[model samples]
Target: YYNAIMACGLDSQDALEIFRLCIYDKQFIDTATLKDSQMQLKGRAASGVVFVANAALSVASITGDMSVVSEVITDLSSIGAKMNSESIRHIVRALGNIGDCEMILALLICLRGQDFANDLM
Candidate 1:
């Protein structure tokens, strides 16, 4: 279901539906299913991070959930720290969708040592 969302390039609403289903539907996704997803997410490149981060931020913004925002920020920070120039560029673009000022600030701070900051101004 999550893979379908990624493959189809669905909008946030669609992606959120899948995310909710993944979180709530006990019969749909088991422990191993979730662990596999987590592993895949951890191994994803910058583009994948951008997609997931964007979806997470969108969900947080719409729901006004700070916890979700924080989680997504953490994921973005972790992935962004390891990405190369092209990946960082995707992350920067996705950052624009994030509504939380604090998250944006944190992302900026994390990007300081990277070359992407030079291109920002």
Candidate 2:
């Protein structure tokens, strides 16, 4: 539910705070009082986290917000979270859109070993 909102390019302090909660505090869990183990599954809870990452990348690319992009990258890296190939594409496209040398270096270092050669070339 929350992921849906964020994926639509909704930028707000509340959204970022909740994103941090999901990444650092494991915010997503059983909403009801039952505390169902299945509902609280780590993978299930993290499903939205990936969506948020993808969405954030898209927003960063369009808005050219280096700080936002850096924050997302740092948050994902600190947690050892892996982005899907689509997210990588977004990062590459952002490099083209924003042309930030620092971001290029940081992302290349962060994504070391991933086959982004075709995109770079």
TM-score of 2: 0.55
Q: Best by TM-score, which number?
A: 2
Can you write out model 2's per-residue Cα lDDT over 5-97, one digit (the tens) per residue?
366473633444555666654444222213432343232233445556666766666656656667777887776655566566667666777
lDDT of 2: 0.58
- The best candidate in terms of lDDT: 2
**Each model's TM-score?**
0.37, 0.55
Model 2 residue runs over 4 Å out of place are 1-15, 25-48, 100-121
Clash totals for all candidate models:
0, 0
Deviation in angstroms for 14 in model 1?
0.9
